[model samples]
Target: MAEFRCRACGQEGTWVYDPERYTCPACGSIDVHFVVFRHELPDDDPAAKRMDELATEEANKRPKKESED
Candidate 1:
């Protein structure tokens, strides 16, 4: 896990692994950069737990628009 700081709001948080884009939550800015090698997280960190929860929620929120099309 990596940490990232929002340039706009200066709020620090964990980095999310997204293939599309990397956006900051603090200020909703996309001008965020990775703060590499800042700290090491344990296997049971709260941020990791929150990430898992968000992922699960997103997966469940996906709309099933079509069957086979």
Candidate 2:
């Protein structure tokens, strides 16, 4: 399972895969975004170190863009 947030209503929680459709459970909004639940960097792992550097500090805190009318 992965976490997701409803961009329209600011609801955040874990989500299971649904083959039928993807919609926010809070307000039934299709506009939603993913959330990373964990981040770890192992000293003995080179790949983990590289991933830590590549990951954005504000990946989850980014402001949503306004939709054009």
Candidate 3:
């Protein structure tokens, strides 16, 4: 079991899937990334969900890039 998030919509979900072929559950987009949680707990564990939220917060806080000439 593994958790995944959609890059396009920030949608989070879980699936027992191949990383190469996984798609976002919310929008059916292939633009997604894995979110590692715990090895002992299932993908839907509350802790995992919380961790995903924190990760998203951190990403949102990152500085934006300047435009190149």
Compare the candidates by TM-score and give the number of the best one.
2
For model 3, residues 1-69, the per-residue Cα lDDT tens digits are: 778889989988777655345578678788988764356455676765777788789989987778756
Model 1 residue 60 CA deviation (Å) reads 46
Task: State the TM-score for model 3.
Answer: 0.38
| Candidate 1 lDDT tens digits, 1-69 | 557788877888786544344677567788787543413444366655666788789989998677877
What are the models' TM-scores? 0.39, 0.43, 0.38
Each candidate: what lDDT?
0.64, 0.63, 0.71
Candidate with the greatest lDDT versus the true structure = 3
Candidate 1 residue runs with Cα over 4 Å from true position: 35-69
Which lDDT tens digits does candidate 2 get at residues 34-69? 543334323545544655656655555677668857
Worst 10 residues of 1 by lDDT: 34-43
Model 2 poorest 10 in a row by lDDT: 35-44
Candidate 3 stretches with Cα past 4 Å from truth are 18-20, 35-69
Per-prediction backbone clash count: 0, 0, 0
TM-score of 1: 0.39
